[model samples]
Target: MVSMSKDTPRLDPAAIVTSAMRIADAEGLTAITIRRLAQEHGVTPMALYRHFRDKDDLLDALAARLLADIRLPAPTTAPWDEQIRAVLAACLAVLRPHPAVAGLVPARILLSEPGLTLVERTLALLDEAGFAPDQATEIGSQALCSLVTLVATEPGAATENTDPDTRDDVIRAKRAALRALAPQRYPHILAAADALTLCADRDNYYDLGIEFAVAGIRGIRPATRTSG
Candidate 1:
């Protein structure tokens, strides 16, 4: 592959984010550095500074791009619970494909237009379901946070590619470790050892969490307003 050099044309902010994402996906977030990006884009490190104030700024831009990739469902007559599930699923779908970027999400500001738009729509859904403004904000924030946590912590979700034998060995090792725990001291854990180490059926696991969140939201009844 031809390497970018200093003689190439100036790199735009979008190009910088794109290159950074590519590096992050191929290697890992740790591989993303201003100097590294500059080298990849055929520009001086100082040129990147012109586009981003610092690494944090560049990461925030990357987060924005990732959020922008989610395609929220259009307004529909679906139940509020279904609406909430749809939004969460859309966000997860985008994050799952770019696990490196997903890990940075908790630290990155979601003030970009696409991010705010998502927040706005989620709150609107809650409001329509009879939740007060404050309640909507709290519940919406918690739901989104829970979804991010799920994606970030999913087993092997962010791991770099590994050959089948190596991957199987890792899984076997984990299962063996879990099984070795004393049943007398950890009865529940011992009983669920197989489920704990199994990485298959992640979609079902994710759906279960979403269902739990939706059920919790439904259980919250809006406060009754009082007037003099």
Candidate 2:
């Protein structure tokens, strides 16, 4: 380890990124700016620029931070599909807490070391599952994008109000509006009103979303590759 010296740059890149993530979690991606972060750190924008080129660099750093948090499941002799599921789950666990910045994932996944490791592992699993390198690249990208979209677009998730009571009220209002729609022409929608309006159980919502993703991949695999 390099010994600390008084000459060391006062601003830590990791520490600054952590603060930016916190700001994003509370406020929104649009709220993150070099000027704003500089104000938070009591430094001028040029000081922040030393660690980040600009806003885009900082955002990329945030995405790298999310990808770095993934606790990728250990390599196993388990079926490729099963291992892929575990990989997806690990990614979900990281991105769920920082939805605002999760949108940055697809653009940055190949740009970070941790993200590259994950992509490499995922592609290896796809190869084991019989997808050619080109196909695996496409499929892996789609699967990751699907997972990111799932977190970014979950119902009622974008709400600024985190208070449980306030959120419940909002859900109830939405449910009522859906139920109030004329039932004569929308019977199917009417029957599914509650499900349509509220993601009542977040865990189930994500579990089912993951299932949909896995099902799509399984359904598309070559019949000749069937394990059984």
Candidate 3:
């Protein structure tokens, strides 16, 4: 005869990832060793193996876990600009909370259910805004990539000490140097340099880009209408 008790407690894979994320958020990815996780949880390393195949598998789980927290507003229900804003805001929020995991996000293969869910929502938003199938796919890919880079690079690309004015000046100087390149050598780039330098507000720029994309898709709404 066997006795079943609710007091025994359960070891969830999700809980393991949450713990790993805590360690990562504090000391980075290197801190997330199987042994360390086991020690924190008062279990053996082999116990974690039961949940994750190895470290990479654990990382995949961590990425999935981090992604799962972000929720995109329903595109069908919300205004197009609002929906896009909501998604980007959510993406930034998620990454901001887990600084250690931000860099790893773009590299890891995000095939997990949560990852797929995020992609599906993004595609649905594009489709709702009237992007053609191919266009939606391409835009979603590009938008996601751009968002990741923007979050990683903007605000603080490097940890050097400088006032905001000095930092802006440094950025401006860099752009000026790029602009100053011989026009004959890179005609189109030089032509666009002034326009690029005018883009100062990172957040505002992102909003504008997303708005333009949404508007572009809306313009094409008359051409092709597809339901997702």
Candidate 1 lDDT, 77-149, residue by residue in tens: 9998899888888888888767668866645535688888888899899988898778888898788777777
Ranking by TM-score: 2, 1, 3
Q: What TM-score, computed on C-alpha atoms, does each candidate reach?
A: 0.86, 0.89, 0.61
lDDT of candidates 1 onward, in order: 0.80, 0.86, 0.69
The reply for model 2, stretches above 4 Å from the true place, is 1-9, 222-228
Sort order, lDDT high to low = 2, 1, 3
The segments of candidate 1 whose C-alpha lies over 4 angstroms from its true place after superposition are 1-7, 106-110, 158-160, 224-228
Candidate 3, residue 110: Cα displacement in angstroms equals 5.3
Candidate 3, residues 1-228, lDDT tens digits: the string is 222245635567888998989887667789889888876766667777899999999998887776777775655576655676678677766775566677666555256677777777777777676676788777766666666665555444432235678867876786788788998899888876655554446567566655665565455543355567
Best by lDDT: 2
Best-performing candidate as measured by TM-score: 2
Q: If both were scored by lDDT, which would come out higher, candidate 1 or candidate 3?
A: 1
Ten-residue stretch with the least lDDT total in model 2: 1-10
lDDT of 1: 0.80
